[model samples]
Target: MTASLPVAPDARQKPVIAVVGPTGTGKSDLAIALAQRLGGECINADSMQFYRGMDIGTAKLAEDEMGGVPHHLLDILDVTDEASVAVFQRQARELFDEVRARGNYPILVGGSGLYVRAALDHLEFPDTDPAVRARLEAELQERGRGVLHARLAELDPASAQRVNDDRRLVRALEVIEVTGRPFSSFMPVRQYVQPAIQIGLNGPRELLHERLHQRVVKMAEVGLLNEVAELETRGLRQGKTASRAIGYREFLKVLDSQRGVLQEEYSVADAITDTVVATRQFARRQITWFSADERVRWIDFTDPASLSHALRAVTDA
Candidate 1:
């Protein structure tokens, strides 16, 4: 299983291979293949996949799908635990060192853009003030994301431009308030923290859209509702990060309708439609994020030579 890949003659360390792309593009499958061929361990960089019992919706790899390769940093959080990129960066680096110590290449794989950057780039997170964060959260709830985002735009245009969600918007404002500096100051540089190689998978837009639609449909067919219902019992609704996940949030609305709480007739099919739209949008954002990085070597997901090209990239690194 341990096929040797070429390294620089004076290379001091093994290069961490990152398989990154939008969802449904077979990033996980490629990561597994690389790990199997290189005698490497796969590290989960997909933020949502950190949660336990989120399998069906997140398209988490099943045990058999792992192809007997050791995977780390998955299923390590509860439904109620808020995922932190800072914490993930620490954990991922630690796992990287451990995997390298074992004489195996560490492969980082996921579509979560910031988490991937935090793992491979020179990123520094600012400290958080609980009071400042709470105040921002309150303002977010009261004045809404648009207003808060405008405020961020006034204070830190760069950070505001990059932030797409309420959580990040709030965090950016909090960082500005806490440090008396622009949140963009903490943004990651393109420089890597260590030796690394990134392989990005992509394909035709129409094909990716169709794949996303089918994937969401498959999630529904395989009992994503049941999975969400189970997580709901375990405080999924109370978890700030977990509750906002694409499929989980949509399904929760369906659950609310079933309980006569929302007074709207939201069916599973409706949720599926919403999830498909949201997932496609998210995939687009992911593409925008990863494509900005020139360090990533692009490969067509539909190309039969993708795996071979990826292997060559690693060997020729």
Candidate 2:
């Protein structure tokens, strides 16, 4: 909102383009190319990539991989620090505005459903009570996800239907208990805080499946296990949020095999398989969430035409 900064004349009044879709769909690559064409910098909205030592597991790009484009909000949190959508909403908006004010474009890129919306939409987060959250989380651990999910189903069926994970279900229950409103009621209206465009990348399900499978295999082959082991030394296991990331958690279980603590037998290949399956499922959920938004201009990630399509969406917007 400051008027002191020099705005580029070529910069349209309000242009923040968000590139989104499922994992393994090359959202980052598209964002980089889009940034190149638009003279923008990317701001990461991926929650896992916030951790400093979580590069390989999160599929973070190396500097050369970034194609000389600057990025923001990456590796800003320690593995032990909890990541919050509310906090990211505040920070990412600041970054977005700062980039835009100085005449550069702000390209928001990530598949983290809530963070992307939190930064660009008119969404507000209710305050949290740690005591209430702790109690609900304890209940979840003791009684299991099914019991808590059923309780949520009774209290707020719509929100319960949206989330099947234990942690998210617990958060929804906590929100409902604290605010006396269904979590789904907090869904943002189809309005942006600023003039913005959203582009989504999608491909055939079979292609996505293969892409994710191959990506997981590459991560495993390229020392994802070693990365997890090093993070364990830095307290990765103690962080409630980072400890549960898909690939990291699966590899952590494999790390547990180092001790005799695990009762079941497993291998690195089994860990890879679990990661691939979980990633595919996660991608499905992401697609479901993004597809519901009618405003997004979607492009096929497998098609070269999508580059031109995405470019047109930005230019026309």
Q: What shift in Å separates residue 5 of candidate 1 from its native position after superposition?
A: 23
Which residue runs does candidate 1 get wrong by more than 4 Å? 1-12, 132-184
Query: Which one wins on lDDT?
Result: 1
TM-score of each: 0.85, 0.84
Scored by lDDT, model 1 comes in at 0.92
Q: Write the per-residue lDDT of candidate 2 for residues 87-138, one digit (tens) a residue.
A: 9998888787678776788999999988888988999898688999999888
Against the correct fold, how does model 2 do in TM-score? 0.84
Write down the lDDT that model 2 would get: 0.89
Q: Model 1: per-residue lDDT, tens digit, 17-83?
A: 9999899999999999999888899999999999999999999999999999999888999999999
- The lDDT for every candidate, in the order shown, is 0.92, 0.89
